[model samples]
Target: MFNKILVANRGEIALRVIRAAREMGVKSVAVHSTADSDAMHVRMADESVCIGPPSSQQSYLSIPAIIAACEITGAEAIHPGYGFLSENAGFVQVIEDHGLTFIGPTAEHIRIMGDKITAKDTMKKLGVPCVPGSEGGVATLDEAKKLGAEIGYPVIIKATAGGGGKGMKVAQTAKDMERAFQTARAEGKSNFGNDEVYIEKYLTTPRHIEIQVFGDGKGRAVHLGERDCSLQRRHQKVFEEAPGPAISAEERARIGKVCADAMADISYIGAGTIEFLYENGEFYFIEMNTRLQVEHPVTEGIFGVDLVREQIRVASGLPMEFTQENLKINGHAIEVRLNAEKLPNFRPSPGRISQYHAPGGLGVRMDSALYDGYSIPPYYDSLIGKLIVHGRDRPEALARLGRALGELIIDGVDTTIPLFRALLEEEAVQTGAYNIHWLEHWLETNLGEA
Candidate 1:
């Protein structure tokens, strides 16, 4: 076990790591920017250091400043909680080069899986299912048209280098393929710094399902199960739950086994998520998140496991204490992300928090850094907190979540609470018949009425 570890992020996740480290009897050092001088994570950690100014490029994302903090604190490892440098392959290599452990996957695994195109190729080679697409980057307009025709109409042109929902476009007719191809290529070059593009068959109504896998360094891997993250907006997940109502036990077993095998084939280490788009009884690999996800607390609640602790144990050359047989998911769990945004249209609303109060009860859990008089800076993510609820069944969980959301109150900023409240009462959510587009369609119908 590491005597000390430095956390390379901010907000609730930073505080989350600090709490876990303290419970395990490990010292934690928190690195923060000038903007977060009095943040909760700084106050909770065993030690703190100010890296730089408020801008992410100069502060949270500053590689040299972070390494200096770790060296000065004599920390043996670093835990990047989600965003920022969590998935940066270069950062992982730098940490290893400095003889410091990065508490995630190896640099090789990160490099192979970081790029979207490379990841798709690797999954296909490993016998994992992937969406039918271009074999490599399309070199000419003729190649794009030929590929589009073979894949059928409504194909999505995507950047082979990077993604942000940018450098991507869809064409429904053959006549429009040439124009869309040029536009996507230009956008990709401007946004991602790469003009390479590929085409893939796009599903109009697909559900996003991801399997969570934990692996030790020596080729031992197991999956904790899957999460249904279909409730999203503009590719950003808002609500998530465990044990998707859409998948059966047989289907879950098949997908979980394949995901575990794929991770082992890549020599993947630590905790990671293998994402898939489930549409017609088949799972097609989309991408793999090489770090802990934002909605991981729901999985922890149902399984009664400490993922952070497990991550540390694996990085320290210790075998996982629990196996596939020992793991058992107890019940239904749901997490509603509370962000500083509007109800229907999620526009950022950042300001001071006047009255702040979180929900409480037997099955309710709140993870946040919110406090009275705290000002939400506009320079960072708009997330305010996460409300997770667990119950013996889906209905019970939904009801508990409704009650919890009703209890939550935050004044002086627009929030998504109204939207969640309306959603819990909708007939689709009550019967679990809603797909990925349900929320967006519902929003369009009741944009401002809620």
Candidate 2:
């Protein structure tokens, strides 16, 4: 096991990694920007380093700075919690070249799965179902139009290197193809520095489901089941639940095994998520997140597993602690992201948190770095925290989430608490009947009332 590991991110996830390391008897090094001088992760870690200014490009995303921090602190490994350089293949190679273990998958896997077109092709070859689309990246508008026609109408154009809804456009007809292609290409180039884009058949009401799989880097792997992330806004997940309410036990087992078998085939190491779009009882591969996901806690709650510890153990050349037979879904878990944003508009609200309080009870967990008097810098993502609740069943989980959200409080900044409070009252949400587009449509029709 590594004696010390550097956490190369910020906010709640950074703290999450630090806590996990501490529990495993591993020293932690927290790297922070000037803006996060007083961040909780820094205060909690065994050692700390100031990487750069507040801007993420100069700080959290600085590969050189993080490597230097590891050298200075004698950290043996780096645990990129989620964002920033977590999925950067180049960064992983750099760390490996420097003889430092990256607590994630191999750089080769990251590179192959980072590109949308290559990822789809790989999954398709592995016998995982995929959405019909161009065989590879559509190089020209003419090619995009051809593929759109072949795939039928209501096709979507997506940046090969994109995520979080960026560099994506939906075209309902051939007339919309040109604009969609151009826009997707431009956004991809501007955001990810890649102009590559691909086309896929867009299902209007598909549910977004993802399977969580873990591998020991030695061809041994297991699946922890699925998480229903269909509750989304503008293609970004807003709410997530474990053991998707809409899927049957048999279907869950089949998909979970498929994901695990795929990982085993590739000898994939560490934790990864294989995402799909489900409609009419069919699952189509969308993408794979090669790192720990933001909503991983829900899976942990239901499966009673510590994913971060497993990730670290895998990186240290240890086999997974359990097999598929040892894993069993115990209950339903729900997670509501509490971002520093105003309800309805969802505009970013970053400032000093004058007051803060977290809900506590059986099966309720809050992952956050906020405290009274802590200033939330506007230089990063708006997610400030997450409230997770588990219950014996979905209905009980929903009820617990409502009580937990009501008990939580954050002052001096607009938050999405009101939005969640309203969502709890919706029958679709309560009964788990929502699709990926449900949240966006609900906001458009009910934001005024909310």
Candidate 3:
């Protein structure tokens, strides 16, 4: 294995990589912006580099700065812990050009899966199920209107390069088509620099299911079951559970094989997630994430494996440690995001954390960067931590999650902990019958209940 690797992100994810590296006897180099000078990851890594100021463009997202950090630290590889340049194909190429290794999928794979239309087309060609809609980008209003009519009402317009619900809009009828199409295109341009939009049949009651697949660059690959990330707000996932409460063993095996086969066909490498919309016992491809996901802990909890360690081992040209037959789902696991945001309005709340206490117990894992005196800077994501619980079954997992949430405490800033606490009381959430739209509807009617 390489002696060192650089973690190219911040917050809890950066610390996740650093800890994984440390366990494998690999030193880590952490690159941070000025705002994160006193961050946990920076303090834990074997070496640290101040990349730039608080601005992400000049700091966390700066290619030259990250490359310079790797050079100065003699880091042999980079582990991009999601977001920023994690899916940027150009950054992967640059690392290779500098004679450094990138601990993820090949640039070609990233390029193919980065664009929505291309990925959908690719999945279709590979015999994976997909939502019915436009075959490609709709360049003009006339074409969009024509396609919308043909696809039927309640279709959604999405940017080819968009994510996080920024460039996605749904139109219930022809009259709403023009606005949604234009707004989706504009949001796409402003958020991702790609105005190209495509239409897809919107599954109103589908659940968000993502299959986690890992490959060894060669043609070998395996799937680690699925995570139900249906709970979200403004397109950001808040709660995720593994071995989807709604999926059966047969369905899990079938879809798991499909995703693993697809990754093997492309010779994918490292960690990747293929997201789908599941409804009425059928699965439709949505998009694929080419890096580790924020909710990966739930998967790890049930599988009894270290994904980060596996990612690093694969990146170092090692064969996979286990086969599909060797892997088994041990139990049910649930993960709830803990963000520093005020409820009701969901506004950002950043300030010093006067008091902090992490829940401790069996099957409970808290991955956070918060401290008693650390002042949360206003320059980054509102997420402060993730609380995960694993139990022998779904009911036990839910109970553990409730107990754990009750024990967590953070002062001086409003958080979303109460939101999750309220969710546990809902019959829909309790029975695992909640759909993608469940959280929004719940928030609308029971805004103050949490």
Candidate 1: residue 269 Cα off by (Å): 0.8
Q: Cα deviation in Å at residue 84, candidate 3? A: 0.9
Query: Model 2, range 213-269, lDDT digits (tens) per residue?
Result: 999888888999999999888888989999899999999989988999999999999
Q: Which parts of model 1 are misplaced by more than 4 Å?
A: 448-450
Give lDDT tens digits, candidate 3, residues 147-187. 98898889999999998888999999899989999999999
Off by over 4 Å in 2: 448-450
Evaluated against the true structure, the overall lDDT of model 3 is: 0.94
Please give each candidate's TM-score.
0.96, 0.99, 0.99
- Candidate 2: lDDT over CA atoms? 0.94
RMSD of each: 1.8, 1.1, 1.2
TM-score, model 3 to reference: 0.99
User: CA lDDT of each candidate?
Assistant: 0.88, 0.94, 0.94
Query: Could you arrange the candidates by lDDT from highest to lowest?
Result: 2, 3, 1
lDDT comparison, 1 vs 3, better candidate = 3
Off by over 4 Å in 3: 448-450
Residues 31-99 of candidate 1: C-alpha lDDT, one tens digit per residue: 989888888898899999999999999999999999999999999999999989998989999999999
Clashing pairs in 1: none
Q: After superposition, how far is residue 108 of candidate 3 from its true place, in Å?
A: 0.7
